[model samples]
Target: MIKFENVYKEYGNGVRALLNINLEIPEGDFVFLVGSSGAGKSSMIKLLIREEEVTRGRILIDDIDITKISKYSVPKLRRNISVVFQDFRLLPKKTVFENISYALEIVGASRKEINRKVDRALELVNLQDKKKAHLDELSGGESQRVAIARAIVNKPPILACDEPTGNLDENTAREIMHSLLKINDAGTTVIMATHAVNIVNELKKHVVTLKDGAIVSNIEKGGYYCELD
Candidate 1:
């Protein structure tokens, strides 16, 4: 559902963050992006989300050329994709239900539809009981789940997560990963960027490794082979 052909991204001061990145993620597939710090994982995501413009080459999502999508149409393009981040990024003052519902509201979903979707999403993440809770009241894992629920509330065709389990304990991380897998099973294309090698190795999913802003390896049913001390 996503493809990048010879993609290159350079910041305003000519710092190249990605180079010749060619990738294809089929619909409903779950893939892991593995890399150390400053290896262009974030850069790839920024390009995908249109947070930064590509310096060269093309990006296609479900056959639509995203690189050429007008600024006015970018919102429409983004409506089909959802992103979760390491920090959760929840509004501090909003309740769990409000946080998830806010996304639908921004998209102009009706009250009844927003309520239904928010509840369904919270259920998916096993957070229905905490719907009225504020972000500060939840544990780190619970907060992360709330972020995931918010991301999927719209039922986006694709989901990209950047280090979703980065800050949690191993067990909690596993739970978060399980939640992501459930989402993947339901047919959303899932791409996760993480440095957690154990999870990637155990899952035996497709893995793309990046180093120095370039793809060092792309393996189907791959393991984490980067040497560690």
Candidate 2:
């Protein structure tokens, strides 16, 4: 389980990005973090991935307090939690297989293991046909699928996505969501931050709404319209 206890985040510029956040996300659950711009959604993601530090309180992943871990252990911690960004941040020149397998390579997995894991990840994202294709050769949705495959190649227990469908059209965005849902079905905890109302309403998943850096509402099977009254 992931737990946030009295979490707070404040920048040096005197901006309070988050205030007294306390949340729990159980294993294999799919959650949507919904909010308007600057609502501290991104700040929460940064804190989860340890890109930023909390000003106060603690964050625990399965009883491990991430807020107090040493800098050297951050990379190891990330192996259990992977992130997919809006930009898709892929190597344009690399083949889909190469891109997804790079994560395993960083940890020095043998070629046999890389191939096995890459194959499984590609299947999970329904991108097996595009394994040999380069990034420029795939459509926007396909590229995002590749990014998802890369994020899950290591079999991380948690996947955090920030504005994953923000760059695609409505149909393409739905396709990307389908892939994400598939990953969630396979038992990975999925936490997504998005502004897509239609998608939120259509899926009717867990929604946590934020306003001015504070959680205003948390609804089971919630829609985008469920913000604080």
Candidate 3:
């Protein structure tokens, strides 16, 4: 579970990015964080990854109070909540398999374990055939799938995406969305921030709309909604 209690975030230049936010995301839930630009979606992603600390209140990931986790434990916390960005963040020089395996290698997993997990991850994204392909050889959607493969290779409990399908066309974007849904179906919590209103309407998952750094609403199995007045 992920919980935010009265969480507030103010930047170094005195710009308030989040205000009195209270949220609770149950385990295995898929959520869409949607709003116009400068709506604090990025700020929430940063806070979740502990890249930015809350000015006040607490953030609990599985009730650990991530706001208070020690420096040495930050990596452990990250492993629990993996993040993916619009940028594929893959090595141009490495094969798809190597890119995903590298994450496990860093954590000192055995080669056999790396192979098994990588295979499974690639399957989850429907890119098993591209394992030996280089980054440049894959299409835009394929690259994103590779990035997703890398993110989930370790089987993390939560995955957060920042504008994941921003660079793709509608068809390609849906492909990316399908990959994410497959991952969510397998029981990992997915919180994605996207500007793709069409995808949001189609998925009809939990939609959390933010505006001016505050959560206006969190609707379950609901399409996009906003206040006009």
Lowest summed-lDDT stretch of 10 residues in model 1? 220-229
TM-score between candidate 3 and the true structure: 0.97
Name the candidate, 1 or 3, with the larger TM-score value.
Answer: 3
Task: Specify the highest-lDDT model's number.
Answer: 2
lDDT of 2 by residue, 121-193 (tens): 9998888999899888999999999999999999999999999999999999988999999999999999999
Candidate ranking under lDDT, highest first, comes to 2, 3, 1
Compared with the true structure, all predictions reach lDDT values of 0.90, 0.93, 0.92
- Candidate 1 lDDT over residue span 14-115, tens digit each: 788899999999999998988888889888988898978999999998788888988999888778889999999999999999999999898789999999
C-alpha RMSD (angstroms) for model 2: 1.2
Q: What's each prediction's TM-score?
A: 0.96, 0.97, 0.97
Ordered from best to worst TM-score, the candidate numbers read 3, 2, 1
* Candidate 3 stretches greater than 4 Å from native: 226-229
**Backbone N/Cα/C clashes per model:** 0, 0, 0
